[model samples]
Target: MDTKFDFGEPESQNTVYIRRVATSTLPEEIREQVPDLDSMYAVHDAEGEQLALVRDRSMAFVLARQNELSPVSVH
Candidate 1:
């Protein structure tokens, strides 16, 4: 699975949306690290600021208002 993280765009002053084109073979450990792909999962940026979780790649815009996006559950 390709683990390259593609940051799409900055939604606002303190938000950025990232897209990782991983394959079905993505490691379980990795998935375990980010179990909430559909929610605003916590990730540290280069500067290390806490960010709100957003949507997965299945949606058009990965970063939207927290209330504007739908939640997706991964098993």
Candidate 2:
């Protein structure tokens, strides 16, 4: 399997972090958007700003790339 690990360098701000988040743990407003899904992928920038919430990890990576951001998985 292909994998990547980020060392959190000075230029990490250019990278986007992808992680799985339980939908039930999200706020009511955000949870309402994905009622059918039990979990989702969260795409966050190095500064911890959420960029997007996708149905899957692959989608998160794709969305990040489309936005010209490098994506790395977090746990």
State which candidate has the highest lDDT: 2
Candidate 1 regions exceeding 4 Å error are 1-13, 30-55, 58-64, 67-75
Off by over 4 Å in 2: 1-10
Which tens-of-lDDT digit does each residue in 1-75 have in candidate 1?
889988886544444344343433345665677665533333223343434332344342434334353333222
* Clash pairs detected, candidate 2: none
Local distance difference test, per candidate? Answer: 0.41, 0.89
Candidate 2 per-residue C-alpha lDDT over 1-75 given as tens digits, one digit per residue, 9 for 90 to 100? 569877676757679999999999999998888789999999998778888888999999999889888899998
Clashes of each: 3, 0
Task: Sum up the clashes in candidate 1.
Answer: 3
Query: Model 2, 64: alpha-carbon shift in Å?
Result: 0.6
TM-score of 1: 0.24
